[model samples]
Target: MPATDRSVTEALHKRRSVRAFTGQPVDPALLKEIFAAAQRAPSGGNLQPWQVTVLTGEPWQAVKDEVAARIAMGREGQQPEYDIYPRELTEPWTDRRFGVGEALYASLGIPREDKRGRLARFMDNYRGFDAPVMLFLHCSRIMGPPQWSDMGMWLQSVMLLLVEHGLASCPQECWAMYGETVRRTLGLDDGQILFTGLAIGYADEGAAVNRWPVPRAPLGEVIDWQGF
Candidate 1:
């Protein structure tokens, strides 16, 4: 409540997926600001549960190369310990998932039948889509689902903070599927598990992928008034 509601709500609305970015490096001061905002996110039982390893310069590119090399060998050798998606998705969730995928690929002229085309787009996630700053986020083993929810709140805080700084981000859960490799390479403790990665930087405005502004359903569709 420290800031005006309009500014807060407007920032939330303006946050979007920005894939392509110029090669400019994110400054340390800016990163400090973003992380500080991330730190302020609400937590469960006062357990923050989240840890972040940000990569840039040689380290970032090195991890990219290592993963790319593995992928080039036709093998995603290291597997995640848990499932990323439910075995079955039902109801409105299923429709929403499909719609998002359709909208995203449609922006790039990728047809539904083009399996390889879709794979190519996912492959971009591996390269951080050539993003300058890559953030690896993980949660501690001691935390449960509620704590995981807190981690998401923190992630959203980081995303909105980036937007306020004129930067864009993409929270890549798919990146966590390579949790083992990401952990080993990033020197994360074994007790910490990769939750996701965020691609951060100025979005390349001209890129086709950045043009996809996936729509959200109207408020009435998702919200119920208590006593309007």
Candidate 2:
């Protein structure tokens, strides 16, 4: 399968963090091709630090089972290797996060008072949101912040490629909370740190959870002007 002629702007506008996906499977060959294209992402000195563990079929089932079992035992797996968010998320950042959560729950018809329902739905993330394919991004402990930035670029490339391939994806940092379980389930060594997880498959367009659109700040607010 060749890369699509989809423009970068079009892909950006169309892409979102897809939370619900259908049971349809993505072809392994297409997965390979998309990741290969993602290799084109820039890295420091061409040292691409991103490593991926692809899961499907039985392996995928096993991962879900382990996460569920651990949760059932009243465990949240292990301490995260790194913080998923700042120690104190303040100002507009907090507002942005809160807004999305409210919008998402509203879309699902889960009222603000339904704490149990929200928690149960949030747990679905560990199961890859039932996506047909899951990808776990990993990087070496030896890598520094620069390499982590490189990993982000690589993942973004992969997400855009998924869109080009008529697929949807959700880059999940929530998996980082269960890093130890991911390492054990995937047989990854201590040298490798779990960065994030990506759930990929066709989107469930009819699902209300997928209908919520999170707002972004205006470019003028984020950008700083320089001398022209």
CA lDDT scores, all candidates in order: 0.82, 0.89
What's the lDDT for residue 80 in model 1? 69
TM-score of each: 0.90, 0.96
Measured by TM-score, the strongest candidate is 2
TM-score, candidate 2, is 0.96
Off by over 4 Å in 2: 1-5
List model 2 lDDT by residue over 39-70, tens digit each: 99999999999999999999988888877776
Residue 209 in candidate 1 has what lDDT? 82
Tens digit per residue, CA lDDT, model 1, 93-206: 888888988988988899999999999998988888788999998978877889889999999998888877778898888776667777878987789888888999878889
* Model 1 ranges with Cα > 4 A deviation: 1-6, 72-78, 226-228
Q: In angstroms, give how far residue 19 of model 1 lies from its true place.
A: 1.6
Locate the minimum summed-lDDT window of 10 residues in model 1. Answer: 1-10
